[model samples]
Target chain A: DVKVTQSSRYLVKRTGEKVFLECVQDMDHENMFWYRQDPGLGLRLIYFSYDVKMKEKGDIPEGYSVSREKKERFSLILESASTNQTSMYLCASSFEGYEQYFGPGTRLTVT
Target chain B: QQPVQSPQAVILREGEDAVINCSSSKALYSVHWYRQKHGEAPIFLMILLKGGEQKGHDKISASFNEKKQQSSLYLTASQLSYSGTYFCGTGVMEYGNKLVFGAGTILRVKS
Candidate 1:
């Protein structure tokens, strides 16, 4: 079975604080993605990595960066968290652009 | 661009049936469906490619219309466990491997 795990289920951070959300997949997929889901907004892509050290910006990448130093791990970084950045963060991995397997999301609260 | 979903929300009884539609303005290479239960990660339902194939899992099924760039999900004899937010992610050929997801449709099933 494919397993995707996130570093946290919930997190709280003060404004202007740095935040990191980690994801790891055991399927050895080549594609990994970061998305933020908000009510009535669905899942909007923040960033994606196709290979180690290879990153691409999705539709909404502002104030966010991603790292893919290894194949199994992907990390999302918020340069300086703001209240508007509060959202449910989801990490997904796919093999060869197929159906994605998602991790339990991290609900971030930026106060 | 994000796909458009019809009927923002729906409510059904345990034995009732419902349909959710997703349409995109751009030409789509594939359509992926997911169900996200409350406080859980989204789970892959199915993927419909450009060939306009119909796929099913248990009592749930989906069809894609390549000509119209549309897809529809059908849930028959719905069960309480079927309650969730349904999202359709569209893959555009020009967009490479990324999928643009629609604002999801919320489904609630009552016994």
Candidate 2:
């Protein structure tokens, strides 16, 4: 079965701290994405990478950066975490225009 | 712009049926549906391509109207395990591989 895995199931950090969230997929998908979900806001795309070293900004990309150095791993980075950035972060991977397989998600809290 | 979803929340009793709708302002290349249980990642339920087709998995089915740029998910004879937040993600040519999501519809099932 295809699997997407996140580095942490939960995380807590201080405001202004730099944070990194890692995602790895065993499916070797060409497209990977990072999304932040909040109550009532649903899932908002932060960034997506189409290939190794190729990245695209989504609707809500501010304060966030992503890296896809390898085919199986994608990384989301918070330059300076803030309280408002606290939410559940989800990582997904898919082939081109197909359905996505998602990680279990990381619940992040910035206090 | 993000696609819009209707009926932000709904409740269903066992064996009841429910429909959730997602509409996009821009023309769509495809629509992806997912179900995210509380505190978990969104799981891929189905994908509707641009051919104006309908598909089903288990007791759930969905229709996509390419002309209307809309998709509706139908849940039949709902089960307790069906309780979760349903999200419809829209993929547009302008956005490339980025799948923009709706605000999501929350569904609760009771006995």
Candidate 3:
């Protein structure tokens, strides 16, 4: 079975604080992705990593960055947390060109 | 560009039928369907390639039309378990590495 785990189920951060959301996948997939989901807007990709230390921006990458220091872990960084950044963040992993398996998701609230 | 989904939201009774549509403005090589329950990860339902046939799960089925760059998901005899947000991911031939998703269609099934 494929297992993807996120570091936190809920998080609250103050304005301008730095926030990090971690994700780990046990399937050894080569692709990892970070997406933020909002009501009505659905899930929008933030960043994706194809290989360790390799990252690419997705449609809504502003104000967000990602890290993939190891194959099993991928992190999403919010350099300056703002109220507008509050949303449900999801981490997903998949084999090359295959279906993705997602983590439970981290709901971040910026105050 | 992100794909477009129709009937932004739908409410149905048990044993009812519904159809959710996803249309893409860009050429697509593949399309994926997923269902995400409240606060949980999205689960992969089916994937339809450019020339692949329709895919189904029990009473739920999906068809992809390469020429029209669209896909439709059919849910028959809807059950309570079918209530959730449905998203369709689109993959273009130009860039096979990423999948662009639609806004999502929310389905609410009542007893």
Candidate 4:
């Protein structure tokens, strides 16, 4: 089975603090994505990388950046944590455009 | 653009059927379905491609309408384990493989 591992299951950060959320996929998938899920807002894409060292901004990419140093690893960084930025963060990888296997997700709270 | 989902939430009994719809303004190359249980990651259900394919796995099925630019997920005889939030992720051909998911529909199945 393919496994997508998230670095943290839960996180609490103070305002203005920098935060990092890590995601690693065991399968050699070429595409990785980062999304933030909010109540009623659904899952909004933040950033995605099609290949190593290649990244693209999604709908809501402000104050957020991504790093994909390796094909199996993708990271989401909050430049400065804010209350509005707190939500359930999910990571996903896919073989092509078909189905995406997601991580367990990290619930982050900013105060 | 993010696809719109109808019937934000639904409650059904075991063995009942339900339909979840996702419509997008832009043309879609593919539509992906995923179910996420409370406090868990979204699991891929099915994917519909541009050829207007209808995909199904087990009792869950989905159809993509290329002309309407919409997709619908059909859950027949839903089980207790089927209770969760269902999301549709749309991929436009011009956008590469990055997907924008719809506002999810929360389903509650009772015995």
Candidate No. with top DockQ:
4
Model 2 misses residue B17 by how many Å? 1.2
Tens-place lDDT digits, model 3, residues B1-111: 989999899999999999999999999988889999987899998888888854445667898898999999999999999999999999898765689999999999999
Once all C-alphas are superposed, what RMSD does model 3 give against the true structure? 1.3
Model 4 misplaced stretches (Cα beyond 4 Å): B54-56
Mind giving the per-residue lDDT tens digits that candidate 1 earns over B53-96? 64436667888888899999999999999999999999998777
> What lDDT is reached at residue A91 by model 1?
97
Candidate 2 to truth, TM? 0.96
Candidate 3 residue runs with Cα over 4 Å from true position: B53-58
Error of 4 at B91 (Å): 1.1
Q: How good is the docking of model 3, as DockQ?
A: 0.82
Report the candidate with higher TM-score, 1 versus 2.
1
Q: What's model 1's lDDT at B31?
A: 92
B1-111 in candidate 4: lDDT tens per residue? Answer: 889998899999999999999999998899999999998889989888998665647778888999999899999989999999999999999999989899999999999
Interface root-mean-square deviation (Å) of every model? 0.7, 0.8, 0.9, 0.7
Interface RMSD of 2: 0.8
